[model samples]
Target: MKKTYKIKVDCAACANKMEEACKKTEGVKDCNINFMMLKMKIEFEDGVDKDEVMKEVLKNCKKVENDCEIYI
Candidate 1:
């Protein structure tokens, strides 16, 4: 399934990092972060729990951009 989320990121490069981090997360099939929009689009892997996956995505994103926020 696909989901869109509001995000807080400082810059384009950090948004790119968040996208990469989210894609690498286990339950995510793909992810895109638009810095200008401050939004994220996520394609989840089959049968993954959305809430769990999002939590992980947030954690992973925080690793690269500490102040980044993903509104669940």
Candidate 2:
């Protein structure tokens, strides 16, 4: 399944970093971030718990961009 989420990121480059971090997270099939829109789109692998995955995504994003926020 795919979902869109509101996000807080300082810049386009930071958004890109968050996107890459999220994509590498387990249970995430893909990820995209729109810096202009302050949004993130994520595609999850089938049957995964989205909440759990999102928690991990947020943690991973934080690693690359300390101030980034993804409103799940």
Tens-digit lDDT string for candidate 2 (1-72): 999999999988888888999999999999999999998999999999999999999999999988888887
Where is model 2 more than 4 Å wrong at Cα?
A: none
Please report how far candidate 2 places residue 27 from its true position, in Å.
0.2
Question: Against the true structure, candidate 1 has what lDDT?
Answer: 0.93
* Per-prediction TM-score to the true structure, in the order listed: 0.97, 0.97
lDDT of 2 at 49: 99
lDDT of 1 by residue, 1-72 (tens): 999999999999989988999999999999988899999999999999999999999999999989988888
Whole-model alpha-carbon lDDT for candidate 2: 0.93
For each candidate, the alpha-carbon lDDT, in order, equals: 0.93, 0.93
- Colliding residue pairs in candidate 1: none
- lDDT, candidate 1, at 37: 92
